[model samples]
Target: MPRISHPRSSSTPLHEGGELALIERIRRRAGGGASTALRLGIGDDCAILRPRAGEDLLVTTDFSLEGRHFRRDWHSPQSIGHRTLARGLSDLAAMGARPMAAFLSLALPPAVARDAGWLEGFLDGLLDLAKQHGVPLAGGDTSESPSEQVLADIILLGSAPRGRALRRSGARVGDLIYCTGTLGGATAEFAQVQDGRGGKTQTASSMNPHLFPQPRLAAGQALLRRKLATACIDTSDGISTDLAHLCEASGVNAEIDAASLPLHPLAQQLTQEAAMAAALHGGEDYELLFTARAATKMPRKLGGVPLTCIGRVVAKKRRAPQVTLIAADGSRSALAAQGWEHLR
Candidate 1:
């Protein structure tokens, strides 16, 4: 709850950006793009997304709920907005889908509903990412919520060349597992933010992983376009847990070399067990997790982010767990699929 602030500035009156007017401003601010995939965007009853010839459309939605996913005292409106959209984009990245259009449904509590500046700040964060990704803002509904929290649901529409989108079920025995960037930062960031509540100063730097997570869009595109990966997924649910998803879908078992993990520098400061747990089980890093045939060579870095090979695919026996971890001392143990759950 560090750096908490009201959604609006105290100097401005609440009526500056009314509902209709605010919607119009958002529509205009989102007009910088000219993506061909969009046939109709904002200001319509329904948005239209046109997939390219021989391409398949992909759609994903993410819900951002106040109090559960975010605490008003912990997140700025802008950061909340950015992270909400980023969650859906991360799903698209996992499938190597090219971003096309987005739909946002915002339900605001009465207190924050009238704060035009707060709404603008939130839209600014969302639209800035839309422009950067070349994804147009499409139509979605907005309403006042009776609850005391803000809720946002973002639906992202994307496309991938016909039959080329990555899937969790594609991994085969002998495939090498790779992950992008460092792990465990989001866990640390979450803890730091929670600890600094009540207006206490923050000890974490501005580059807190929770506040600013980049979708591995380019890396995912490369994986599919180049046929480099046999399977793919994003790491919002933690490495250990997501790996289980991949293995279960592919009907395989996995072995991760704990020492080979691309650990965050902060891991060095934590106790050994804590560092390992955080790196393997922390959530929301939004990095890409992929599998490639052992014979295939992959880039050491993509989009300036390092990719480290940490594990490999193995055949799964009936009644066996989907994942296992190998310690530095060569001890092996079942890797539990424990991570952040939206419903938990």
Candidate 2:
């Protein structure tokens, strides 16, 4: 008889029931409330909400895991803490909502919890970013974990005028697509840090892009105020994948001009190919990609942020559901829809 092998039981408390299974369990535990504003509760980019006759609300949540989302060796406790808050805040920005407050939940291992000063520094970093955006830290929970990893969950709540918040499914065919700020710089810097090349000698610009990402709140708000964007989504999962998401949600396809993509100076300096691959496939850019009417006259800059017109939405005519890239020579090629899919 052949010997049989059995899978080892998971020691990590968080992973004991598996991540997806845990989320499903929590979903079942949650009870419904009598809130007219809570249009969507969970299972979407952000929770859709309409407050009162004159108000709308947007709520979003994001989580950061030490080993999977970040590493202590590569990032300071401050950077990690700031990013944990920024991620959820960026989602609020994407919906063109004015941020109000945030709730944070931290799960710390015994090793990390033993350092009181480190914990203070982490909270300081989180508070600093929250204050800069005029977002208050409302409340949260802390728990000790058996693993050697630190995890944080941030929930943000923001409000907008009734029927004014942007959604991913509003894009129409022939709408011009635009992106705020250049891309790929963050991924390049992350690559350097992961390769052990990031040290005291690294340039400020290179480190800043990766360490600190600004959530384009003002720009998104302005876009909504002007009714310039028909559809909007933040580029946390890279331009290519996010565009695919917008197109998918809108029941359309997109054609991007490769030559028109905005390349950050750092991305250009670091890679001769302009890091277009990273810009297209790398995550964590936190920039906004929105679509507007083709004939719409958008300002060169919005709220002091530069906006670059890069592509347009097109009707899907029997083509495989994907975004197409048009080269400078007018040759068209299909772009992959792959990005940072958590399950993969």
Candidate 3:
């Protein structure tokens, strides 16, 4: 079990400020106006959202639980807060949507709530990301947890042109597969952090993929504007598992080139077998995995992130595996959905 500690000290307990005060603190820090899509926010029973005319609204929700999603000992409050919002934002990104507003419901344990430092860090991380994407923290609920764990749930709302949002089921046989950014950095960084080899500083510029994975929102939007992707999904559950989801949704198969896999520099530091496993199954990379028509002339990068053609979609063969990995020496093997599956 990880011990929880607050970096900064405060004489006032969270209860002294009360729940309403907490909400007010968040509302004051949430600073808005960048997104005109959110007409009214943060003090109302319901937030008013005005999606651009002819655009469709997209909503995604994710839960971040202590022990399951993060550890108080291992992850900083800021990282915890960032990952909470990032999870929901990445979903919006995968669908090629522009985030408009966010709702956060938090359950804090006494240990976390008692100290103002933790909440400050958490809000700092979450609001910083929200500002970067121009998404307003419109509304939410806060409560004391019955148990000793912190729980956070974020609901993100986004918008996209009507009939233009990407879908995983749009992939067709022969569409080339591509992914934004490199792979396995999250898993590699997690291992290093767990083993006490990771960095102590937590800055946005730091190369801590596990702690602060960047959601590929811009890349997803670029694909939408250019109409380049036939299908898309964010790599939140790792490529192996998420690709299986895409294949199942599209009723197609995929063949990935093992040698062509874009391994993250951190992943390369591991042994060959470990690196390969991490590349295949490391979850929470938050990169976008997409398919485009084979004839499309894809640029070298999208939204400032490099694009790599890792594979191509294929017609599903009867009784054959849905995904296959072709090794450097002409060997082929079935690729299983081995990444982050809950309740297994």
Candidate 4:
């Protein structure tokens, strides 16, 4: 029987079709290798791995889908490609691992595949990021799709010293919560870029934060090396939501001083209260949120990135798993978890 060209329509809600089948087909094409070290590749019950002695493996995966995660019309193919890889690499950096290799799986609309330059540019962007971090692309698959959306999934593998991986569950009471770089600037930029009101200056600076978010690899690694962080997580899900994750994992609550948040200059200029709200709730910042002992005198900056003491982890109270924001006037309010939620 001839293979069906496309998956069932989205409205049909069928189990099969579109990108899912394409991924399976690609896995079947890459036959298994005979080496024991070739632990996990395509088509497996679970990815098996044999870690080298004295090393702990770090693994992370991220997916980018057009419209849902990004828009092809607004972003160039190169930017999309770069952001996809950066998102996954940032996860590895959060663990303070040295990047080793990456694997990408792409689902391309027929239109995009036909444009040779478009694909080349996208690959160029991905390759450029890989070279900058010394992580090479090991393998991936490509396929055609009926939808105009372009979807990319990246898997990154790295390694760290044995038994030294940083985690979000390690935070303790009285630990100071800190974050790198400025906040809310990316969301403000997104608003302007989407509205077309972002002039050259806003377009250049504001939107760039959202478009090309830098992973805090160096700072994360340094924190790990210095044993300064008891807990860590990448701030892809806004400061409020991400901090909440750490608190939840550590069975603690958090209090963030609203006045203490380090707002990006662009965010201050382009947005005011609402923008600050978005910065607290908006996702995709890709910065690092971490905790250290209250006595730890963290530098004002890490790897030239400004470090802000935003709040502290506290014992779980009756209303546990809550994040509270303290105003400058000493008034206390609930910090809403308004970050990205797919189902919402």
Local accuracy of candidate 1 as per-residue lDDT tens digits, 13-62: 22345455556766777777788877877765667766778999899999
Specify the highest-TM-score model's number: 3
Our model 4 lands, by Cα RMSD against the true structure, at 6.4
Q: State the lDDT of candidate 2 residue by residue for 102-189, as single tens digits.
A: 6666766756665655566566667667767776554445455547888788888888899889999999999999999878878877
Cα misplacement distance, residue 278 of candidate 2 (Å): 1.0
Tens digit per residue, CA lDDT, model 4, 178-233: 99988886686677657654322211222477766777788888888888899999
Local distance difference test, each candidate? 0.79, 0.74, 0.86, 0.73
Question: Worst lDDT window (10 residues) for model 3?
Answer: 1-10
Q: TM-score of every model?
A: 0.90, 0.82, 0.94, 0.82
Candidate with the greatest lDDT versus the true structure: 3
Better of 1 and 4 by TM-score: 1
Residue lDDT tens for model 3, 1-344: 01112325443344666667777778788865367777777776677878888999998999999999988878887888888999999999999998988998887776777688989998888888888888888887877665789988899999999999999999999999999999989999999778766434355643788888889999999999999999999998889999999999999999999998888998999999988888889888899999999999999999999999999999999977889999999799999899877211
RMSD of candidates 1 onward, in order: 5.9, 9.4, 5.3, 6.4
Rate residue 160 of model 3 by lDDT: 95
